[model samples]
Target: MEYTSRHTDGKRINTRSARRPCFLPGRIEGYGTKLQRDIDGKKTWNDFFFHVVAPPAMLDHGVWPDSPTGYRAANEEYCGHMMRLTRALFEHLSLGLGLEKGAMAEAFGGDELVFLQKINFYPPCPQPELTLGVAPHTDMSTLTVLVPNEVQGLQVFRDGHWYDVKHVPDALIVHIGDQIEASMNELEPN
Candidate 1:
């Protein structure tokens, strides 16, 4: 479920508080937000994962600590900006591949493309070495545009070993997913 950033008193809610659902009587919840728990009930990965569709609905979700007008406006604006940036990247790829200017965008569905943002929040762990914030896995999308954070926790597996991905301020990292790699292979002269 999408969560607002603030409490009713307007104090910013940290991920720790947000992760726990405070089910108060007479208040409805579990709307537009989803909670995924481990099947085995054992602690495996500790992270808050949220899926936001492009043109994000306010995390407010008609719940208390209703998102402030300013926050909602800013989020909308930010999503639009990111969408434009992604489209530009797609165009660049199209041209670099010697395809039509809008070929890549067209393949991705142009304006109808669904821009999905997977926001993961891994809180500070006391014994981080004992817990895994996220299990290693491959993304099933065509591409993943990762917005770097202050903490350094990303690792990539190559031929024989895993290498840590260094965090750089103000840099965006794009990882080509399986679908994109397959498409590129299909385009190669056989």
Candidate 2:
């Protein structure tokens, strides 16, 4: 999804909560830069792998406190903003496909479902080879949004060409899924 910088200085408190969706406009840029997960330059692959693996192992019969479920309630600022923006886009896409603005919104039966965000970083390899970040797959959601930080490895086959999405800042990439196709089929043909 698109993002914008929110600047806050150390004196006055900014207390206004986000009530509406925010649209970030920008095109993806650059081609071959590497995305690093080390925000403070202190994290390592060991850190990422351990956390990613440990969560599912704990999800046997009960909910985990530190997983996506916990993150949503605690990260309201990010979650709320994301909810608004996502709902808005879904509405727009619904209308574009000849449905009412809130038509798709009602179909979801309220937004109590868990939202998961995964960031995959692919650093430059010495050979840039003999490694696969993720196996080829299809997204099972209504849409999949991807933002690449640098090195390009994502590819999708369509028609006769393989489309490559290079890394770009503030780029919101959307991949439509089978459910959306079904929705489109229900709309009255114009």
Candidate 3:
């Protein structure tokens, strides 16, 4: 399907959840639709990635796509609102746990250090068991904001089971990584 990065975050970051009502953005009513363009315009899923995904400029960050700023700008635009809420959450996390109001902000230098957005497209497959669209990996940054194309693929490493991340329209996924967890140690305490 033709996946627009703009539409991706817009649709996925807003589902209501009983656990954390504030975790998601605001949901849009009756906006679900099928894939617009074929996953990668290939007759099948395997051919699609070989023909399209492997040759993309995004793969070769040094040569094919020389500009990193473009990626940054696109990410900021897509996740601006989520960033705001997250910042607020962090601020509260710091203070409620006995830190300064802007302590988290100051540690990162009073400005957002980095934000990255990844857009993935997975076409329908007869045997999804044979292959994976994107293999599992941990994000290198402090947090990861994800909006998967559909419901069946995404999973997270929790206590034990591979918990599926259900697509709740307009809801942003904010997962704190190891470093952020460490930073919060003094406050939350392991």
Candidate 4:
């Protein structure tokens, strides 16, 4: 997409060199070059994962027109598409569960739902066997729509094995996150 391509378009800010502060949900972090995961006080993972988070308001307010890479227009366009898709998916899911069309959307706060855009960039690793690009973990969001590039590295742990996710052109993968799993558990009978 245009948003992803803008990273190399020379007009976008170089997040690695800019050293800007990123405010995550629970913690604040400084921009860094390498990707490291502290597993019980030991640093692991030899990979490069760069990400940019855009708040919901940014979707409404366009990015600066002449500022470097023109990421604002691209990001804004992508976010709008995602928002509509997510809403439609929620509606279909609610119907599948034998509920009204807007039931799931209503539970998620309707028009006030907060949507944040996160773009992750993972570069090549020298010793691929020695480290992981992203540590194995469940997603924390209510839902996640992933659009991976041609180089496929995504995997899912299932049936006691890690299975590679085959890449499909022009396809989007939707993952049910922890929130949905928790809600399903609560709905289960004793």
Every model's Cα RMSD, please?
A: 7.4, 15.0, 15.0, 6.6
What's each prediction's clash count?
3, 2, 13, 3
TM-score for each predicted model, relative to the true structure: 0.67, 0.54, 0.50, 0.71
Selected candidate, larger TM-score, 3 vs 4: 4
TM-score ranking, high to low? 4, 1, 2, 3
Error of 1 at 11 (Å): 25
> For each candidate, what is the lDDT?
0.59, 0.46, 0.47, 0.60
Best by TM-score: 4
Model 4: colliding residue pairs = 11-68, 11-69, 12-69
How well does candidate 2 match the true structure in TM-score terms? 0.54
lDDT tens per residue, model 3, 1-190: 1222333543322232233221124421112223222443322222111111121232322211223447434544545665676578668766876778877656653563443334344545555555455545576556565654447667887787788778777666777666566766544321
Report the Cα lDDT for candidate 4.
0.60
Encode model 4's per-residue lDDT on 6-116: one tens digit a residue: 234533333323323333464323222334565544434432222323444323232222334666667668878998999999888888887778877777667877665
Q: After superposition, how far is residue 16 of candidate 3 from its true place, in Å?
A: 37
Deviation of model 2 at 137, angstroms: 1.6
Q: Evaluate model 3: give its TM-score.
A: 0.50
lDDT of 1 by residue, 1-190 (tens): 3343434573334432353354446533322222233433433444343334453332333332234446445655776878888888887787888877787777766667766655565544444455566666788777688898887779999998999999889999988777667788554321
Ranking by lDDT: 4, 1, 3, 2
